[model samples]
Target chain A: MRTRTLYMGMIAALIVVVGLVGCSKKPPPGEIIPPPEVTPSEMPQTERVPGDETAPPGSAAEDAALQIEDVFYEFDKYALTARARDTLTRDADVLLANPGMRLLIEGHCDERGTREYNLALADRRARASRDFLVAYGIDASRLETISYGEERPFVLGSTESAWSKNRRAHFVVRQ
Target chain B: MKPIVHRFSIREPEQARAHGLRAGPFTVALLFWAGVLTVALLFCADAAAPEIDLHGTVVKRTLYRVPIVVEDFAIEASPGERNDPLFFSGGERPEDLLVQDLRFSDAFQVVRRRQGSFDPAGEPPRDIDGALVEQPIQARVVGRMEWDDERLRLKAELIDQGTGNRILDREVAINREGELARPDRWAIHRLSDEITRYLTGTPGCAATRIAFLRESRSGKELFLVDWDGYEEQAVTGLGTILVSPAWHPSGERIAFTSYHRGAPVLVALDLESRRLATLSTAPTPAAAVYSPNGKRVAFSTTAEGDAELYVARADGSHARRLTFHPDIDTAPCWSPSGERLVFTSDRCGRPQLFLIDADGSNLQQLTFSGEWNDSPDWSPAGSRIVHVCQIGGRFELALIDVQGFGWRRLTVGGGCENPRWAPDGRHVVFALTQAGVRNLWILDADSGNLRQLTASPDHSYNPGWSRPARERIRASG
Candidate 1:
């Protein structure tokens, strides 16, 4: 009987201890448990800003009505083809019609070469176009040349048709 | 009660002996007290004993990733302020930027707590056992963003989970005017680099910037971007073709080939003063690189009717030809000691890598395996040369030892070229094309880990990595 009483007392003490531990005070008010890091949200889409010159200005549509054709070059060659010279002759005629107009000849290349080398080649192409216009009785001061290298393609696909269109010197009119 | 006492009472020694009993209550009480004393002594001994020191043997692994936890950022707005204007609408948050930087570092495995969880404001827990529950977080980073009247402040703390000690705490600030003038990414980059240094014992690449060519409708202009691809800005707005941008060792200037005057010429731009100075007066000058000491420059020019390498003072004076080969020699990269150069030449009937003394004495071919190899850049440690090699009509990056042995191809893709080594000598950043779209990619030299650094829809090529400006200053000092 004495042993049974001791066992009952120990069981009661354990129950009280467990109850006390469970009823412990809560954390202080206004304390926040920091959230986990590394939430994988969707990546923001890159949007072109309004004054970014990723493409030709909207005014180029009006200039395209002038019927001045862009000049093309052969693959890996900056020298103008015979057909390219013929196109430049007509562009020179357009420049002659408007003496007050200044022309920006943007040299471009197809996406098939190294960037730095293509840059040099495009520069040569632009200068070639400028030289042809200067020799065709157009004022040299009215012509400025820039090379876009393989950047700013006229078409997006990697086809021969697209590459042929991209490998050209486009003329833009500036007043 | 009297009957129970009598029943429980112990007999005397003579009565116990007769009854075959061992002892009475006195002896029993004594033995119980002795047992209690022994247990108490054991408890005392355990409390006063010193802890055992354990030394573990380390096993070398091919790759070891440090586990780190990034806590959600806290915003502390100033009086009357509602939000931070520095962050773009729907763009990356401050914590996002930090996480991106850590991920690209390839040194840490970042863990994030559940979304919308609140962090208790105050000091972090004082012991690893106190902070961790289920995850194996080795380190934790907590950040707070404070915005007040045109000024933005970012405070970050790096805590070591093992010791529960705060390893680093840094605060960065940027003004509204500065944000409008330049992207505020630099401040975050500086903090990220500090955190990396605290964790890895070496600085991170966040402070390094890359200069590449961006195609504008008018021309291809040189542009600059931070290593994380933020702060995209034009370095030169000359409305002409520019290429081959090479950063000076000091990171204060850049030399590139520009066609502003109708022909290619080497031009140097001072980043701070925004001054443009022509470096080459020749008709065609391209591919300029600075010596390791930043005191001299070497470039290729066609003034002699063929492309040949030339060396000049940093100020573009005292120019002299470095190579007299009849074949074309371009893309001259100076050795780290500035005693020799590795350049591309076609003297062997095709473009190949050749090494020559700084004064143009001992000419030796460095590559003979590839039919074409060009754009050779010497490693910062002067132990290897990385160049673009043409194999099966596709361009790939190849690394060759300085002693001309152990040639290794680094890129699995055929459209990788123009590999430039990082200042740490363990990473190389180069241009890679996939599906005809060119972007910049970085590769780890030892582990062969590859990561795409840029993901712009437009083409980004000709990347030039900068040395950490802080490290450069420390070294010079």
Candidate 2:
């Protein structure tokens, strides 16, 4: 039932995102900038993003939109669990539906690991989630990954419960 | 033996005179009234009056005598306690409280009273015993215990055996029924510390813990450890890039940064609950931290594409931009008082020490000699700031007093990067490598005696000392 709700949100996010195919703007090489004005109706009718071939056009209208319920990890390990797989599948569907959708899989860990190592571990974890989704047929280009390490914890207690919740990978919608 | 119950204060003499208390003869009038009063009343009045010194002694080591006389030491029991014969398990009572403390200090050669009655005035002999080569002296630790409302109070004292004089005294009045009451172990440790101070003029380890960061190829994690580097436990295990773990006003929580996702975001991890909370990830990731009580943190960020200094609460609130027109300001440490922040900035062509207020005012450059001085860890007593300054391609831990003077080297030119203070402010912990083996080492905050803490397994990179949480704040407040 929860996945169903997430699917609904994914569909809504896709409809709006697919309308932004290759139309998804990016800065020129070597500069960091945002997408400029592009009409939803003017989006290319190709199977992929016009300028960005990595995007799958009209996939947002398919059964590709997935839902993910924050997947958490153990103390310092970045490998996802069986339960985390379920969430990743949902997120993959969302990425698959909107070829124009670029995702930033933010990896996170609890406050039990070192800062630098956790950053790398979180990156691995985020990549783990992204790799699984891509293997499930989602385009890698549309999916971006980064790690915040144990620096950004969702919960703020030094208890097992808090640590469990903090060691996780959070999904964020990209422009 | 009694303490000379004489009260002297800045306002004592004037107040005593105003109250018509003259120096003629306080004992004479008191004796005259005591003759008409009962013994209990007489004792009560005398308890508050100037106490008479039946005996007093102070221990001092001599080139000739290791057996320095110590005063105010005695042993006593209240009906039944750890020392009762009924609890004796071996040659002597294993649970004897004072005896255990006496042995732990390793300062004295304790001699227990013989089974015979104590000869209060009988001298043992003119010649010292040959077997007693160390120190030949007797100590008596007396504890007066009372129970009230289910709580126990123990007032302790120590003295020289021969003179029966008071040398040192302390009290542990515990109300064990409440949540705030400390554990018996804590009280015992405090008691042991008082004894050490009484003998050595300086206190020994009793109330102390170590904080360190475990480093690995994957990520660096923060850990809290005992002084012996035992009981080591990870505090922040967010397997991401972690840097500069600082004890919050509450030692139970720590403020640090973990690059879990993208940018270096500041986080606070509660040591007890193992919970992690992101304090700030918006506007820009928190660079450094001073807790909400005003402990300043040193953060690395690029507000202008060059990493700069910004102070924020350990909880990620009440932040203020501390440096402007900066080259690259980072690593801000809060003085124990939280009034000033010591940090590193490249404002002078390279990283050097800088001082500023919590609100970003009172900006002043601190280091003039070092080419690069980074990682400023403010002393727990607000006495000095410990940091690393580059010296001929290598870095050393240097401590600059609060006045930016008395700059002294803590670690000789070596691979020391970070310098953190122990709770008692006597030692510091840093990371160094030999033969390409990186490890954490502890150093005397005064003498700079480098002692390796963690050798193998995963190299200890950045070590953060854990100051007691409540004391961290009270020390600053």
Candidate 3:
């Protein structure tokens, strides 16, 4: 029994080393330094990145610089537009190429209306994007959803330009 | 899914105005304050009756405001404690807070006069000499401060200038345990509330606490501040996003939404024990409010696909769904009777207020003029409902009767939202943003007067006014 436990520890260590080597081989361009390994206890400091347990040690930096595009929506709308559908189509291709990757889809809204209503609207936006990807042959278990309502914004202004940028569905690679 | 039902006819903006005119102003005032005397008696339960007959003016919605003046507090420290730093420092004076508390009630127009210091152990003679030329002062308040047994005691008196009758005489004391260098705010607030009750027929909101959300470096968290926006303290330190705080009727627990575990969930925090118990783990739980009786809770969640309303026991068992709309239907606020709820829905193309029975029947629409209306809070007085109405692309505070009689805007130029009525049902605390700065302000809907509550650089919103806790009366019988 003790021998089996020791063998399990060795296998986990070998898997971590292999994952780190594969991540360092083709680092995304403009990413010279790798991100420090984040433990579960240090999750509060990096709030935007909620989950990083199953991914490689330095995958947080790579997740931040992912090549996937975000899907945008109009005011008080979650129905996919032609442009949003096209963007999600390309995002689906990226997911198909990386079979072992999992994604966390974040839905955000502009700073208008009541906070609770904005939360419900943003949830619909994230679910709408996830459903689109699932229809394009992506595994349903690979996608998870969360909505920030109007609390977190990409831009900080009340103008139309800033508001348009804020109403979007952002993607982060979890594994 | 239950089909959408419309019980009342959808009237145009012009037709609604005509209906309001036919109903008349006296009926509107009568319907608005029909429950005022009952609520006032519950707050002010003393043996002696009101000194003056001001209920007629209050019940009829007259524009008559009592003119009053507050005199500087006299210092009568014991001989050995004369030079104590507590009485000599230039901090927040008890008299200044007393004046602010009285002015915020909107029942009095107050002027502060600091005449040359008075004799510590003597009483000043009374005279009817007019102070202001525009309006003669009709009443005045005087206070005396001293030390006894390592505690601060303040003796306050209210004098009616019209008849020179001493209406109220009260004494408030505070311990020396917390912040001995300055006068105790709780004592001064108690004195202010006592005086307001004798002068006006209604009690003041000075002694209550407001629970709200304040922005921090990490994220938004729950905070508790006095009704006058002093002594701000954080109640939750999870360093994550929190929203929509609702106080239990007993003022012992607060239910709000917390995102500590990466998804929004409803939880209740007991102020006395500091224990948090999860109420609902449904998908996207946004707004949760306690019923008037505190036995049940009504909230909005998207557990079954779209945003819907649910009613559950206080311990979050025996859950029952209330609404089944495909479009967004959320933000459920209960009536004082706890048998019905009013929520915001977008099924009518734009967000508007909708009323439904707790058993999911007899659905009716409430507002007809605004392009968007949301966040409806039923008044504790059981007559009016206050909400946010969008007029010309700006959000402003508006009020409507429960029976859909009168619809009027309380503020102009917009930028107002999340309005919650005080226990007195006359004042409203809401968030107002002007020129990129957001702060909380209390509005007197009856008189159109406003007083600023918070002025922090960080934004503060989602104010939840707690019911005034019952304490022993300190006024003369």
- Cα lDDT tens digits for candidate 2, B413-477: 46665667765565677776543445677666653334556644455666666544334322110
Q: What are the per-residue Cα lDDT tens digits for candidate 3 across B269-326?
A: 8776667778999988878988989999998888888789999998777779999888
- Candidate 2 chain B — worst ten consecutive residues by lDDT sum? B54-63
User: Candidate 2, residues A112-139: lDDT per residue as tens digits?
Assistant: 4234334445665777787788799987
Which candidate gets the maximum lDDT versus the true structure?
3
What are the per-residue Cα lDDT tens digits for candidate 1 across B1-477? 011111123335687578886764545555444544454444444333312111121111255556676777787665445434454224456777777777777676776653334243323322222333233556788888776556667778888877878999777666555323433566666667777778787667777888887554566667777777666666665666677899999888989887665545677887776667879877457788999999999987657645678899998899899988765678889999999999887677667889999899999999987677888889886589988888787777788998999898766557776788887676788877764657787877765667667765456788899987566533110
Interface RMSD of each: 22.4, 27.5, 26.9
* Model 3 / residue B435 / CA error / Å: 2.8
TM-scores for candidates 1 onward, in order = 0.61, 0.50, 0.75
Ranking by DockQ: 3, 1, 2
Provide fnat values for all models in the order shown. Answer: 0.04, 0.03, 0.27
For model 2, the superposed segments whose C-alpha errors exceed 4 Å read A1-175, B1-189, B192-205, B216-218, B282-287, B291-300, B468-477
Chain B TM-score (each prediction, in order): 0.75, 0.62, 0.77
Docking quality tier of model 3: incorrect
B308 Cα displacement, candidate 2 (Å): 2.9
lDDT of 1 at B224: 76
